[model samples]
Target: MYIPSPFRDDDLENMRATIRCARLANLITATSGGPLATPLPLLLDESEGEHGTLYGHLAKRNPQWRIATIGDAMAIFTGPEAYVTPSWYSSKRQAEHVVPTWNYIAVHAHGPIEFFDDPDRLLEIVTRLTNIHETSRATPWAVSDAPVDFIAAQLREIVGVRIPITRVESKRKMSQNRPMPDRIGVATGLAASKLARDQEVAPLILVQD
Candidate 1:
């Protein structure tokens, strides 16, 4: 990820928050055939490594897991994002030099990826993933709710994924490069937007203030 100095975010805790809040991620690998990518939900274990570890699963038949990767895999987690029009910038009226841009938060985790077929590990991963997403519901479902045999059978059709993160890159482009007046304009404009994502991004734009 090419991040300008003003947009660069090196805070580890902030990166972790972004990862946890992201509903899904894009896992990319460079294979001998070509580049392959899969969109999946991955959980981060911050206590596991110097950086962190990622856990997820892929369908057994997904060729991405079977193919060998050329280098370390990358997991991309994107948080709230919104389109910013120049009309929202005060500079547009003063200098008429402002152009449209985007405001977003993204974290890229790179590490060696290992694929395993161990049933025990797969069960643990699935259980934790399920709980993370379901615990907020009134009737939270759990892996134990299903029959052992049924769960075991389902696990056979999937492959477990583990990535010991070697590095992380985070970027938060919330108009930090713009002046205060322009940023305030952007925040108010986004807060007025009907899009949920835009509304979510509105407060982030003001965090620097």
Candidate 2:
């Protein structure tokens, strides 16, 4: 990723936060045939490695895992992203020098990829993944809520995935490079947008001079 200095994010905790908030990740691997990718939910275990470890699963039928991976795998997590119009920059009105750009948050985790099918490991991964999402529900569900045999049968159809993240790169491009007036204008413009993603980005770049 070609991250400009203003957009680079190096804080480990912040990067982890971005990963945790991301609903899904693209698991990509370089293969002899070609690069294969899978969109899946991944759990980050912050304590497992120097950076962290990722846990997820793919359907047994997914061929991406069946191929021989050449080297490191990469998991991409993207957060709130929105198109910024030139109209939002106060400087645009001054000299017409400003152009449109994007404001977004992204994190890339790179490491070795491991695939496993052990029923017990698969069961644990699914159960943990389920709890992470379900705990926020008003009426939360649990793996134990289903029949033991049914859960086991379902686990048999998927392969567990683990990646110990060795390197990570993160970027937070939220108009931080813009002057105070321009950034304020951007925040106000985004806040007025009806799109939820735009609204989410409003406060990220919001600052008081």
Candidate 3:
């Protein structure tokens, strides 16, 4: 990610929070054949390694897991994002110098990729992942909810992934480069947008008083 100093998010805790909030991540790997990417719901274990560890799984038949990856892989987590129009910039009329841009948050985690087929480890990862997403539900579900034979049969169709994070790059382009008035204008414009995603991203770029 090409993040300017003003848009760089170096706070480790904030970066981790963004990762946790992102329900899905894009896993990218460089292979001898070419580059392959898969979207997956990944779990971050912050206590595991220097940076952290990522856990997820792929379908057993997915060729991505069979390909060889060089060195490390990347997991991309994306947060709220919105389009900023030139009309929202105070500088637009100053000298016709303003152009459109985007505001968003993203985190990239780099780590050594490891794939496993151990049923026990697979069961553990699946259980933890299920719990993480289901905890907020009124009727929470668990992997153990199913019969043991059924669960084992399901696990046979998937392959587990573990990546020990070596580095994390976070970027938050939230109009920090704009002046106060311009930022405020952007927030106002976005807040009025009909799109729910725009409304969600608007407050993220609000200028501090």
Candidate 4:
């Protein structure tokens, strides 16, 4: 996360928002063998620890959980992202220097990685995670919907993860480095893009002022 001063997002609330909106995250760990990474749907517990805690699980057979991490693990969460073309810059017409870049939001959370197999804690984490994602559905599902034996059998196949965040680096690169005219040009160009992510990024670029 090489964030320039202009693009750094230091606001705690904003950082939390980005994490919450990110449904999936890449969990990376350094091991004696090599680096291992897994993509998982994670839940952030902002109430825990100074920064926060991340909760997720991996398949019981996944080797990543077996290896001991040398240091803190990193959870990478990415928000809306779009490619920005130099043609969108007003400087293009003035023969001024301009190059293509990307506009996006990302958060990197680093913390000590803890793996657990306690069924109670696993059930709590899984239940909360399921509720969070299913709340928007007309027929929201719950862990209690399944029989106790069935749920216990399913839980046996997974292991729980708890990462107490020690550091968080957030970046929101939404054309904040560009001049007003260039930003407007970018917004206009992105708004017209056929990609939904580009359209979503267009407003963020325009709202930065």
Candidate 5:
């Protein structure tokens, strides 16, 4: 992540918040075949290590788990992102130098990757993951919702992942580089947008006030 000084986010809590909100992550690893990436839901355990630990699973048939990874694995998490038009920048009218850019939040975690197929651990990981995503629903589902034998059989088809995070890089590119007037223009413009992502980005920009 190329983060300018203005957009750099070093706050651990903020980075964790972004990861939590972004349920899914792009897990990438360098392999002999080339680079492989998989999109999966990862749970971050902030108390684990210097940075944190990531937990997730991949389908047993996914060759990524069986491949020999050369170096550290990277997990990318992205929050709300929106296209910012030149019309949203007040500077566009003043100097016409401002073009278009994007406003978004992203976090990257790097660490050695480990894959395991221990049934007990896999069971616990599956249970926790299920609860995290379903807890908000009226009829929340659980691993126990299904028969014990059925859940055990299902777990056999997946491999567990554990990455003890060594470092984290985060960026909150919400037009912090723009002047107050330009930022206000962006906030107002995004707030009025019919696109849900654009509207979600509005509050983040407004907080810069």
Candidate 6:
């Protein structure tokens, strides 16, 4: 991720928040054949390593794990984003110098990836994934809700993935490069948008650091 100085986000806590909030992520690996990517839900363990550890799984038949990887894997998590038009900038009215851009948050976690077939670890990953997404429900479901045999059968069809994050890169591009008036204009424009993501990005544009 090419992040300018103004947009660079070095805060580890903020990056963790983005990771936790992201509904899904793309796990990418470089293989001899090419690159293989899997979209999945991941659980982050902040206490695992210097950075963090990510847990997820892929279908047993998925070739990504069977094939040898060339280097460390990368997990990409994206947060709320919106399109910013030059029309939203007050400076554009005076000089028309501003162009359109995107305001968004992105995080990349890179580390060595290990794939395992251990049923115990697989069960743990899926159970935690389930609980995280189901906690808001009136009646949350659990892995114990299913018959042991059924879950055991299901677990056999997947391979567990673990990545102890070695490094991380992130950017929070919310018009921090813009002047106050231009940023306010961006906030007002985004706040007026009907898109939910745009609304979510509005306040971030004008955040004071």
How many Å off is the CA of 41 in candidate 6?
0.5
Q: Cα RMSD for candidate 4?
A: 1.0
Residue range 143-185, candidate 2, lDDT tens digits: 9999999998998899999999999999899998999888988
**How does candidate 4 score on lDDT?**
0.93
- Between prediction 5 and prediction 6, the one with superior lDDT is 6
Clashing pairs in 2: none
Model 4, which residues run further than 4 Å from truth?
none
Tens-digit lDDT track of model 3 for 81-193? 99999899887878798889988999999988999999999999999999999999999998888999999999999999999988999999999988988998999999999
Report the number of the highest-lDDT candidate. 1
Backbone clash pairs for candidate 6 read none
Cα lDDT tens digits, model 1, 1-209, are 99989999999999999999999999999999999999999999989999889999999999999999999999999999999999988878868777899999999999999999999999999999999999999999999999999999999999999999999999999999898889999999999999998999999998963
TM-score of each prediction: 0.98, 0.97, 0.96, 0.97, 0.97, 0.98
1-209, model 6: which lDDT tens digit per residue? 89889999999999999999999999999988899999999999888998989999999999899999898999999999999998989998789677899999999999999999999999999999999999999999999999999999999999999999999999999999888999999999999999998999999987747
In candidate 5, what are the lDDT values of residues 134-196, reduced to their tens digit?
Answer: 999999988898999998898899999999999999999998888988889999999999999
Better of 1 and 3 by lDDT: 1
Q: Give the range where candidate 4 is weakest over 10 consecutive residues by summed lDDT.
A: 200-209
**RMSD of model 1, in Å?**
0.8
For model 5, the local distance difference test gives: 0.92
> In candidate 3, which residue pairs clash?
none
| Whole-model Cα lDDT of every candidate shown, in order | 0.95, 0.93, 0.91, 0.93, 0.92, 0.94
* Candidate 4 lDDT, 80-191, residue by residue in tens: 9999999999889998688899999999999999999999999999999999999999999999999999999989999999999999999999999988999999999999
User: Mind sharing the TM-score for model 3?
Assistant: 0.96
Worst-scoring 10-residue span by lDDT in model 6 = 200-209
